[model samples]
Target: MRAFLRVAAPLLVLSAPAFGQGGPSPALIGRGRILATAADCVACHTVEGQPAFAGGKAIATPFGTIHAPNITPDRETGIGAWSDAEFLRALHDGVGRAGEQLYPAFPYVQYTRLSDADVLAIKAYLFSLPPVRRTAPANDMLFPFGYRPLLRVWKWINFTPGRFAPEPGRGGEYNRGRYLAEALGHCNECHTPRTLTQGLDMSRNLAGGIVEGWQAFNITPDPVSGIGRWSREDIVTYLSSGRLPGRAVAGGPMGEVVGHSLRFLPREDLSAIAAYLEGQKPLRNPGDTAPRSGYGRPDPDRLSFSLGGNGLPTGRGLYVAACASCHGLDGRGTASVPGRPGFPGLVGNSALGAARADNAVLAIIHGVPARGGRGESFMPAFGAASRIGNALDDAQIALVANYVRAQFGNAAGSPVDATSVRRLRLENGGRSPLVVGVWAGMALIAGLAILFAARLVRRRARGNGAERMP
Candidate 1:
């Protein structure tokens, strides 16, 4: 009877209803929707022109490409077949259905901190989406790393499974902010630098790291290299709209984050994030002694023009012709007219002031699209396919970018070259040499273990033979 009950118990649990068995309550589904938005699941899961959550987006990592799986409710290709236990396991343990270990690229490390209730809520929300029958492309990872079983070792070393608990004596706002920033938002995944093993270096949390070829600027409270100088209002404004005049504008991944995710967040939630960020310890990059400064004024002599024999416009001439109309010859932006806000000032702009010139080059190549609730002022792209601006080649774009940096950004001696422009234009993904080294080290350890095991076996066999002879 005991044995029968045990077997029956297992069957009963399997047959039990999952989170959204007979359709979740409207309030529960709404909560789940909010959580999903906060998590920005759509950003990673959805491909352009495809049904939401019917994933085919390719997330590039230092190791390889990880194609996001369909999360739509399709029984064959999406999460429709996933049980509550299976879905929760994916969130809490980073394990997929069929007991397959999921890659960290899915950020299960952060999701692991979510409570059971939260996980179920998210699952319920996902199940509410119209199921699409689509399968994502397979991951294109390099050798050894490509082996999914290797993730077991990776998880064992880096992953710590648990739910987030609020710190004692902290205000509600602070705690809420911590949960949102660390768990729901997974801000550290990109903002914080990775260890040699590609784990988050929590010791230097939010001090800044590179992602996708663009600098994820430091958000720590350090006055020199971080956001220490930013007011809470500044942070909120930036988060709400993705722009802060005279400070910075969002681009690349950040732009997408703003346009799609952050801008939609409520004011109180934005405030919470700002509060949490402000409370963090000030961290600065190595050798960053002082705050960055903008160039006071552009020198007239520096704007001298000299055309190439090929009749291509000189850097100064190009700026004068292509840029100076809106951004005056003096490099100060023109005043707003009846409809437009005119051009943004180049001097002291964050993109121009950055240590690396990639952002500046990207802006010149791709141009700033109209974003947020901001009116229709837009910067036309100068790349090959630009409809408004001259379809300048790599050399011309580099020339204009370097000239702006030197004259308006005080980066006079350090110039961006054609080669750098070409590279940035072609390669938007950053490489991870550390990931390669980790794989190599793992191989070495495995080899040594095998050799040691063989020696032990040989010694045991010899001992057994000696015993028989004796």
Candidate 2:
């Protein structure tokens, strides 16, 4: 703790310029509020019943789980006493107030590009809030992830890439819009696809990716596959209201985003986001439509459960006894979560995409939450609070895993056995919290900003040619 204080004390002295420039008045606070609207910082940083900005929210990932830390004014546990300079380091340099490296999950890569003034305005607003004395919960990670220092290595590879900004020749609104979407907002945290190393796949910028167990549909302008069908007006309506009359409704994590953050943004900002998004390169088929093996769209009433000697018997028995109550006998999932057209039938649902069974294996091993667009908050996490509590052992877990694979028709072609499940359980034992997601509503706004930019450029060139024709 003494070391931490040493790291932070120097920073406390340097940041007075940024935070104090705004006069710390209510009017300045209002300006900061406008900047805050662009960033959507509160959604991930604050939890309900908790002081605003005093983090401790949980988020899930493919590897394990992670928790956001406290950013409040508590001198001991939170950043309460942090200086403006220190706060800037945390945002732009991925360093904490105490000079320790912060995890990339905090999105410093995106924040690094923020204009100095904008960062200061945000800092002023945050400092103005009433200090909340709350400490953040610890994150639960496996071996390397548990070691926070290792994050520096991840930054070495990924963070070295660069920050987001528009080309020099771009329009002012487009550039400002880019700053709002990429820098402060860090929208890529959910929208951009990731590489196997878990780094953001910048090549596919905003093409859409899966997050929190739901398919984050592509917002690109691909006519057949993306949201190219929606007009700019259609885009603003959805982001501001969380629903369009005929297009779609928000589901999963998106509902929370619209509920908490996007709605508060200025109408102009919404339009800019919409314009920028619509202008992105259109993907041919931008969705996770791959079906799991062995099962085609199953007819609930006439579905067959024959194993054909390919599945594990032990797992089949376990499912009948344990999961059938809520998930249904044929895995049709009853009326409770009738599920989406392409997503129903766990035996064949695409999340069980590959036949390897690791994904499905883990879900049954540990309870998967609010998956496949079924937003019921009914299911409970079983990691730390299971009745049997890791009782299945390895072989049993593997058998159950294999049973699901064969039963669900996953074609990854790898066999899951009790051995695999035991290994995963042991490996994941130290991990923290499960995940959950939202109500009925559609999320987003349409912005064909890029496409419009291209058209404007073409028009300008044509006019120049006409003038030169004399």
Candidate 3:
């Protein structure tokens, strides 16, 4: 470890100057690479199991799927040919490969606040990689909305990209936090709600918004619906442990962000993150107060994973022993928050109620994530905590699995037995889950073709009628 650091130190000092005056330092680039990981840049840009920067990753969205672009230095296809000025322009201004307007889906609005040096460093590190000569798939946009010019309207209403302007009186940490939240970290990308035209509704920044299918919960200081319940220490601990005392483990995209991203962030940046998160507005829930019907509360004190005649118990004994404290014997969750937009009611979570049962069990088996939209790398992974390192016996996993399902709200009558949980655990063991995208482009093309054919048929019928009349 000492030797590697020694080599890095000199390499940075020697190569950093090559960046030209105000260019970039090798050390800065190196640091940026680490920050990029902390930002989980690759999680979206590079699909799981693929080599880095060879883009083919899919992101789900309400409009359609947006694929991450190639980040390598390939001259013909990647950014190899781009100059330092062009690079800065792209990040600071949100322009595309040909200076075309880029959609907000790229999150450049968040990146606009990054320092010129930080942006250059990240670009340099990206350039240092082995170029992957792959072209990104064309964005699947709906008609009258597909062209690049449409973004002019999007920008007119939503975007205000530029370097962050921190308050002079604020401390260094607060300033740093502001920079990250506004620019590179883009906490609001997920947290802020969007309008019908798909522009960000800035009025409700950090108030929790939905993107694709997943919801990015409000990170504000609201006591009822926000992170106001968490102390600064609690936020830090969750960032480190992926588990909170009263709250659950971060899950979904948040898990990938932590395992692959936040693990590399500097301690100071992480601290800055906590500081910023601690200052958001409290959650102001608006809606129909009645809880969604059908999911009934579990009978407390009844802890059995019986499968009719069989006892295929999974994770039961473990939950009773380990999780029964704050969560209570029943998985009913808290009265006001047990089930809501962001805080999914465990008893009746759709993921838990999944017909296959694997998704729900896996969340418990792996751990729930705290991945809401505003930031990346805030969640942590706990696969080891469960001791499922191919180290624990199958029976152990099953005991806890059944325990959570039955205790939570798998069904009003049916219990998720050990056999169900064991089957799921074995099926998904050791595999990294892939993010899926909705391909609306295919549907759009099909619709166009059908329209074309209908026109042709109508023209032929009119000619035939004219000949018959003559």
Candidate 4:
């Protein structure tokens, strides 16, 4: 009996880690893969033409560029040597294997809300990937801002480390949606506006912000500026297919997001996200206003216009040359027959109707492709070095964009200048300069405080010496 007990105990000990609560079963690994997809890990980690998850993609932030590290299981170059506890700390506490503070560019602030089981599941899936030995580029940040220790201060001021707690009395769907939206999906990272300190402003959660030159439109419940008017099905369709007939089409970064992440999500998950967004507190910015109606009616005079009228650059001439064939000189889209898919209408469209002209300009600069599950209705690119249509200069793109906004969108005389177009083109799309001047100002103040403290200490030392001299 004693011999049997000893053998049985050793066997149990050997098998314990595999069957434990955080064990790496096939089901757990599969779940982790789905969660990682929802998190869009590949969008930031996988560089073009590189091995998957080798992680050399450069992510631009207001402070500077941060290169994502290899998360593969390579012992030296990846996370192969990391323990489960270490990985959890990295996700939940934003600490690295060597105890270095990870930059917020990794979105650990949002990831901190994930449960231990979720974190371990992710680790399990990552460990399953083939290890690649490629090293990532070093981060390119400005002086003092590049200091890793400075993150301690940022975390203390901005971070609240805790797993998501389901709100009492809420239905399971709502709670599940909250977990997916707030933690796994990290939707607020793009949609929410940032404070002066570069932290997300919770009061205006999902109220929208510009990310990488594309506007992440408001997803809150406000009728004017948000998706309050959209039904749950509308949200689901947009998430699943990236477009909603007459309303708006996803382009730029959002196109990538839908193509890579949301489209692959199950219908149940998409429904939950819609439910959660619908239940959010309504928030409206000061300039919120509805789209003007009756702007897309046909204009007889402009219908027969020729390209390059009077041999000078005019918005009308450009639109006639570049856009008239598809969108029609009337500004109403072609192929509007019932039961047939049609090009998006220019008038009263959310992309055009929004107070900001950025989306409209962006569509012109970087053409919207057929995405999500929506069938082909491709728009050729006109921006510089475009592969499809003739590459239009910044001025030409601006002219056409402004014309559409005024003539069709009823956003007449809205400001979208050549200079702004040039900047957006040059920057490869814009991020808010939220951290630029603020960090410099803080550094100056910190230096002054240090100098003041040193002076005070010197004065006190001199006073003590005088008192001791008798």
Give me the candidate number with maximum TM-score.
4
Score candidate 2 by lDDT: 0.58
- Across 232-310, the per-residue lDDT of candidate 2 in tens digits comes to 8888887875555324444445656676667766677777677767757876553423322224333243333334364
Clashing pairs in 4: 213-430
Q: Give the TM-score of candidate 3.
A: 0.64
Global lDDT of each candidate: 0.77, 0.58, 0.58, 0.76
Model 4 reaches what TM-score against the true structure? 0.85
lDDT of 1 by residue, 1-470 (tens): 11211111111112223344567876566667777877889989999778999999998876778899999989999999999889989999999999988999999999988767777877888988888999999988766567678788789888999988877877767767777788888999989998877889989999887676677888999888888888999999998777776677787778777766777778787887898898899998876654543443554654556686888777878998888877778776778888777666677676776677788788778776666565645677888575564488888888998888877774743578888887776455434465556666776676579679999999999999999994
- Quote the lDDT for 466 in model 4: 96
Shift in Å, residue 215, candidate 1: 0.3
Error of 1 at 221 (Å): 0.6
Task: Arrange candidates, best lDDT first.
Answer: 1, 4, 2, 3
CA RMSD, predictions in order: 7.6, 16.2, 11.1, 7.3
lDDT of 2 at 197: 55
Q: Which window of 10 residues has the lowest lDDT sum in candidate 1? A: 4-13
List where candidate 1 sits over 4 angstroms from the true fold.
1-22, 293-311, 324-329, 334-342, 372-376, 410-414, 430-470
> Clashes in model 1: which pairs?
none
